[model samples]
Target: MSNTPQKPVIGISCGDLNGIGLELIIKTFSDSRLLELCTPVIFASNKVVNFYRKSITEINFNYQSTKEYNRLNNKQVNVFNCWEEEVAVNPGQLEDAAGKYAVLSLQTAVAALKQQQIDGLVTAPIHKKNIQSPDFNFPGHTPYLKSFFEAKDVVMMMCAGSFRVALVTEHVPVKDIAKYITKENIVSKLHIVHKSLQRDFGIDKPRIAVLGLNPHAGDEGLIGNEEETIIKPAIKEAKNSNMLVVGPFSADAFFARKHYDKFDAVLAMYHDQGLIPFKALASGDGVNYTAGLPVVRTSPDHGVAFDIAGKDKADASSFLTAIYECIDIIQQRADYDLNRSNPLKKINPEVFARMEDEDIRE
Candidate 1:
């Protein structure tokens, strides 16, 4: 929104205090290459960070607390301490205090993003169940951020190098996905995915592939009518919208030899449908990016490994990818603004008019 030419200061949301989030941030901030790309600011406690670094061998970073970001022109990691009540954290353990701290960090980073202090946020993993205390009752970071930014019609995309996959329905049961699939949801997701491919990833015109819910794509409706009854109508709508979207293709046949190269992204019906192939390809380096968020947001595609939290064995590949993606997205988003056409003329009213409740089941 501002015409400032300064490099984006990425706000890092330290996930669980005891989890690998702290370790990942510490490792990333220590890298000289990462520090040069963008200003790194951690919304966490300095004490907790130091405690985790001691358990590891190679930890070289200058962590300092700061309330004013303008005064943080120095080339050191800045910490925004949001810890309300101090509590000792033990690695490899799930404590309520750690959960509370995770949430507090998220809240602070979000506020900084709102104030235009940070260009984007790269979040560390947080235990979902532990963080839903009295103050926070939302789902994982995506939904919670949607509510925070008052944004709708966003999608979750996982990327590792060239592999990019977006989920149509996230954090929902597989059975419920069939019932929720509609022309509106699919079209909305298609538009965001298409725009992101072009606007965020710098693909001028992107080809997108849509996956099916049933095996063999319901065998042309013999195995199940959902392929024709629900998904087809949605694909038709997306195609009419000028989105380069293809298929209700069988997920089995879709990920075959160089299948992903044909399209920029594949829209899956649910989490496992997309993640199964994505994780298989990306492995430990998968990065989960929240597409269509008001501010750029990404996270490592793995969970809080409570078993190996304190063992100093957690791989930080995904963490590095998350930070790199955040920087990439922010830069792309900025460049896109300069080169993009007038988006007001591109917004399709028909896409939004399709009611989400209008589910077809014939």
Candidate 2:
């Protein structure tokens, strides 16, 4: 067998064909340096790729049409044509056909992931409204991927540089967020975030900061009792279980004073609580990563910009970051698993004996 480590094959799901999905993919892949990192397979039709190439920038990359992922070419972009049916390509238009094809592309890519044909998936933005179907009845990709992978729980963690954030309640209405902030939900999410930090991000002893649901952490129960009843108990339980978790911190001061830098990750109570600060801090370079999934998945922390679909005004920085994040996470998970299975057992016999006895006694 060759000694060279095989590069990961990242599946790129073509989002709404009418939006800026293909545009971002094409632009990001235009840089030849990216090819050296991992092979990319766009889960879209050759016709759609050609349509976007002609409409957008004059990129010099070529794609090979392949029916099976095993035939993927490492030198060129691979277009795993999901369907051959002719479809309209109206940039910036939101129609049922665009939604239909988007789902088809995602479903095909997800199947490939389950088969291990692709090492990771970097999804493009899909329009939430028109993409609804019997198969994809969820509100967004996070939940869809959660159910697809059959993961017990997943965290919608957003990352950009030093700042990392995961939400407890995502895509739920503001009015209903309080209802979802129960003790069980908070504890489950905390465990997911903590485990993902160690396994996926390579943090050996992860330090997670949990944000309070109410402003000022309910000002000590004057604003709300969630901090006292739900969040505080969860934090206590996590710490007692030997997890390096802290806080019920006030959301405002947490980010305002740059306190997020003190920890490996932050667990915000709701969508806006986490994302508002993450987006503001990350600018346009944030990547949304689904934690606790058996398969790796990342997406640009952005939505399909229907207005700028064909104008080439869409920024590819976030998409590029998502690709890099997926590759890094894949490598990290590999290292984590290897370390776990073959841990360094070089401790002295006496020290090892003592540790074992302590564990047994406990």
Candidate 3:
């Protein structure tokens, strides 16, 4: 860690102004520990930021916008206003301007990421179909960014403190889940999840649990054959590569305390398989992370929460966690890259092999 270079810069994608995105952003950045870890910048409108602050806090922002990170800028919140549009910009009010502002914020943040101005990104939740213009017709943030960056390895992993789950298929219907479930898709997500645990979470050997598509792991092939056909081959291949991969565990039993403690990350077959428990335990505190991107990207797990917007009741725990996770990922990635440069000096293979054997023995 001491040998690793550079503090992470966090770029926040401002979501819908009508949603609680602004409130959470304002509240989370108010913490001083956040400033110590990374330089926080907002890709949003000054007007929306100001409106939310005054409405929620009942006062002007204690900080001001700046161009760079410095001792003086540390206490202030900096914003890069992307859209120059003017509208009422009221909280709890859904308008096309609010939707447009969301896109502009993401565009500016993505540009900054590509230009190397920021180390990572933490996006606020945006209303997917609402942001529907001829230009911005993507389903959700993960797919939208995946398409724009042309990322083959891009996968969505949701986090709440220590619990992390990666999705094989996201934002698709339950019926379509069967159609999209394939050997290639399963293998790809498994690889991404394994790499993310090693790179982002600093886990030298990640124990990955692959959840099943049907009840009781398809009741031994009577209910479904995805377990026998698609999943088993992928697990066998991963183990042959010296990866600690396991299961087509029933999603219901796996979330139990006795079961989940065994693995580093759970690979869900579809959206609801992973998210049902994620949203249940973490709820407002869950954070969504996009694994396998060239840069780190995370966001609050929950949606816009338009119903509670301007009520000053939105929780900022997930937003703070997202920011903190970005910092940790950046630091970890730096160490991973540095270690790669000096691979000859890495930990001895005998020692690693012995440790792997010890873990297996346990």
TM-score of every model versus the real structure? 0.91, 0.93, 0.89
> What is the lDDT for 30 in model 1?
77
lDDT of 2 at 330: 89
Cα RMSD of all models vs. native, in order, equals 9.2, 5.1, 6.0
lDDT of each: 0.84, 0.89, 0.81
What tens-digit string does per-residue lDDT give for candidate 2 at 1-362? Answer: 11122588899999999999999999999888888999999999999999888876567767789988678998888999899989999999989999999999999999998988889999999998999988789888889989988888888999997579999999998999999998888889889988988888877788999999998999999998999999999999999878998999999999999999999999998999999989999989999999989889999999999988889788999999999999998888886776576454345657657877778523
Q: Estimate candidate 3's RMSD in Å.
A: 6.0
**Residue 239 lDDT (model 3):** 84
TM-score, predicted candidate 1 vs. hidden true structure: 0.91
lDDT of 1 by residue, 179-296 (tens): 7777778888988999888878998878998988888999988898877988889888888888888889889778866588877888998899889888988878999998887689
Query: What is the alpha-carbon RMSD of candidate 2 to the true structure?
Result: 5.1
Worst 10 residues of 1 by lDDT: 353-362
Flag regions of model 1 displaced more than 4 Å: 1-6, 341-362
Better of 2 and 3 by lDDT: 2
Q: Indicate which candidate wins on TM-score.
A: 2
Higher lDDT: candidate 1 or 2? Answer: 2
